[model samples]
Target: MVRTRLINHPLVVGLLEIAAGEIGYEHRGMIRVLCDVEQFRQTIDLVVEGD
Candidate 1:
């Protein structure tokens, strides 16, 4: 996926729409868990560095 300052770009909007539709709801939970794990890892790294 590409990020653009132009939120209304037709091609990017279309591509995101198609991608969103293709990702099933069943996989959302897994994605959320992965994101949570990433956040946790970052938090741990920050704590370690503070020592």
Candidate 2:
């Protein structure tokens, strides 16, 4: 904590911020990025299974 505070450089800060946000999502108060990896789906089968 003390070491990082001493190095108040923009580049370092930006990287550190990203790393922190990635791990500390709930506490940091930031928007989340949700993504869909696989587009293909068995829609009929999924619906039947759910029912």
TM-score of each: 0.35, 0.34
lDDT of each: 0.44, 0.40
How do the residues 1-51 of candidate 2 rate in per-residue lDDT, one tens digit apiece? 113333354534454476566666455564322223231123223433454
Give the true-structure RMSD of model 1. Answer: 12.2
Candidate 2 residue spans exceeding 4 A from truth: 1-6, 25-51
| Model 2 global lDDT (CA atoms, 0 to 1) | 0.40
Clashing pairs in 1: none
Candidate 1 residue-wise lDDT, 1-51, digit = tens = 212343345533443455466774455433222234455455445544554
Give one clash count per candidate, in the order shown.
0, 0
